[model samples]
Target: FASGVDFHSATAVDMFPHVRAAVDSGEVLLEWDGKNGTPPKPLVKDKYASERRKAKTLNFSIVYGKTVQGLSKDWGVSLGEAQELLDKWYSARPEVLEWQ
Candidate 1:
C-alpha cells in the first residue's frame, strides 16, 4: 500500500483509528446505499461496520486493476454507481491513484 499500512486482525479501515474516523465521517465514500438507484446515495456512517469490508475490498481491488464492471458485480451495483464510488475514493486519495 502507498501508505505502507498493515493490519493483523481488522482491515486498515477498522484497525486504524484515523482511518475509521475518516470512513465513518464520509471522508471516504465507500459505504453506499444501493437501494436507491436513481442517484446512488452515499451513507455518511458505517452503522453496521460495512466500511471496513468496503475499504478492504477497494484496497485489493485497486491493486488488482479491477474495472468498474468488476466493482459493479462485486458490490452488486450498477456500473455508474461503481464508477462514482471509485471517482470519489480516488478524489479523496489522489496519492493512491498516483502511486498506481
Candidate 2:
C-alpha cells in the first residue's frame, strides 16, 4: 500500500521508513498470581530513545553539511572513525551523497 507521503517533513527526503521487530515482544512485566491460570498480558513498547537520539544527531549533522572533522568533534570519536562512518553511510545511500 502506498501510504500518504509527508511532503512537509524535514527529513522526508533523507530518511526511508523501516519496520523493526517489536521491542517488548518477549520481555514482559507480568503480574504474579497465586494460581497459574492468569492469562499473560502482552507487553507492547518499541521505543529506543537514546540510540535514536544519537542517530538523529548524526543524520541531521550530515543533512546540514557537517564534515567528517565536525562529526568527529561532535561524537568525540577519532577522525578515522568519523570518516569511516561517513563512508559507510554514503556507500549505503550513494544517491544522497551524489545529490549533495
Candidate 3:
C-alpha cells in the first residue's frame, strides 16, 4: 500500500484512552524468552559467493527497472546468471512477481 492511501484515514481520540487501558493490562508479554535459537549457517564461502550475491542483487535491481547490462556490470554477474536469479526470485515470490 502507498502512503497516499492513508490520506483519508481518521481516528477518534475517544478510542485512544480505552486502547491505552487495554495495553496496560498484563495481557501482552513484551519480553523475549532467553532461549537463543541456533542461527542460520552462513552461506558457504566459495568462488560462487560473489556470484550468488551478485545474482540476487541483479534480480532485486531489475525488479525496480535496472537494465540487464547495467545490473550485470554493477553486480559482476553474467547476463545469463542474472536472468536465472530473476527467475528464481520470481518463483519464490510469485505474488510480488505478479505485482511487478
Candidate 4:
C-alpha cells in the first residue's frame, strides 16, 4: 500500500517534469522529497511532512471525485485544511488547474 502511494506520487510528479524540476531546484516544495541521486535528501524539509503527505493524498482524492468532507475525515484534517491543500495544489500546477 505504501509503495503504491509512493509509485502513484512519483508517477504524478513524472507527468509534470517542469514541476519536478522546480521542486528539485528549490523553486517549489511539495510533500514528497525530490530524488536527486545516490544520496537522497528532501529538496525542502518541513516540520509538517505528514500533513503534506495527506495533502498529496487529498490531491489524488479530489481527482477521483472525493469530496472535501470525505478528504477531511479520511485524512484527519479540518475541512479548511483539505480545501487549502487542494487550493495550493492547483495554484502550483497551473497547467493542470487550467485543464480542469
Candidate 5:
C-alpha cells in the first residue's frame, strides 16, 4: 500500500519544511479534496485563483514530460502564457527544477 512512499521519503524530510514555511507565510496556499476527511478545508482564496490553477496544471504536466505546445492546448492557454507560467514556476521551485 501507498507505493512510492520510500521514493519520496527524502523529499518529504528535506523539502517539506520549505513548503510548510511558504504556506505559513501566506506565500502559497494548499488545497485538496475533503471527501476523505483529510485536508478537510480549503486554504485562503487567492486573488489570482484561475492563474494559479493554470500554473499548477502546467507544473504537473511538466513533471510528466509534457511539451509547451501540448500544455497550451491542455490548459487552453496561449503558448506565451504557458511559457510564462513555467518560467515563474521554475523560478519559484529551483530545486525541483534541478531535480527534474
Candidate 6:
C-alpha cells in the first residue's frame, strides 16, 4: 500500500491474487498492540448509523449496477420493494447516490 500502487483501479476479484500471494508467502504479519487507545466515535450517531446502514445497503447496487428489476431478482423481492430500499439508501448517502 505504501508503494504507491493504487489498488483501487483493480476490480474486487482482481485484487485477491496479490492479497492471497502476500499471505501465502508470509510477507504479511499480524499483531495487536496492547495500547488502550480510545477509538474515535462518530460525530453524528443517528445519522452516521443511518448512513452506514444505507452504504451497506447500496453496496449491492454499486457492485451489480443493479436496476430495480435486477435488485428485485437478486434479493427475491418485488421491484417496488427494491426501489424503495434503493431510494432510502440514496437519501441517506446523497454523495454516493450522486456518484452513480
On TM-score, the leading prediction is: 2
What order do you get sorting by lDDT, best first?
1, 4, 5, 2, 6, 3
- Those runs of model 3 whose alpha carbons end farther than 4 Å from true positions after fitting are 1-63
- Tens-digit lDDT string for candidate 1 (48-99): 3455566667767877899999999988999999898778667656777778
lDDT of 2: 0.51
Tens digit per residue, CA lDDT, model 5, 1-100: 1342221222222224554455567664454345667453334223334444544455567789887788678868899976765675566557776777
Q: Give the range of the ten consecutive residues with the poorest summed lDDT in model 2.
A: 5-14
Q: Taking the tens digit of each residue's C-alpha lDDT, what string does model 2 give over 1-100? A: 1333221121222222321233224333212342776436422211333334555576677889999999999889999999987876576457787779
| Model 3 CA lDDT for position 99 | 75
Best by lDDT: 1
Estimate the TM-score for candidate 4. Answer: 0.45
- lDDT of candidate 1 at residue 19, scale 0 to 100: 60
Error of 2 at 43 (Å): 12
How many backbone clashes does every candidate have?
A: 0, 0, 0, 0, 0, 0
Across 1-100, the per-residue lDDT of candidate 4 in tens digits comes to 3443443344345435554675677664445433554324343224234444544665678678787788778878899987865665666556765666
Task: Estimate the lDDT of model 5.
Answer: 0.53
Scored against the true structure, residue 45 in model 5 reaches a CA lDDT of: 28
Residue-level lDDT tens digits of model 3 in 37-87 = 532332111212444344444445756887657756775889986565556
TM-score of each: 0.52, 0.53, 0.39, 0.45, 0.47, 0.42
For model 5, what is the error of residue 70's alpha carbon versus the real structure, in angstroms, after optimal superposition? 1.1
- lDDT (CA) for every model shown? 0.61, 0.51, 0.42, 0.56, 0.53, 0.46
Considering only N, C-alpha and C atoms within 3 Å, which residue pairs clash in candidate 3?
A: none
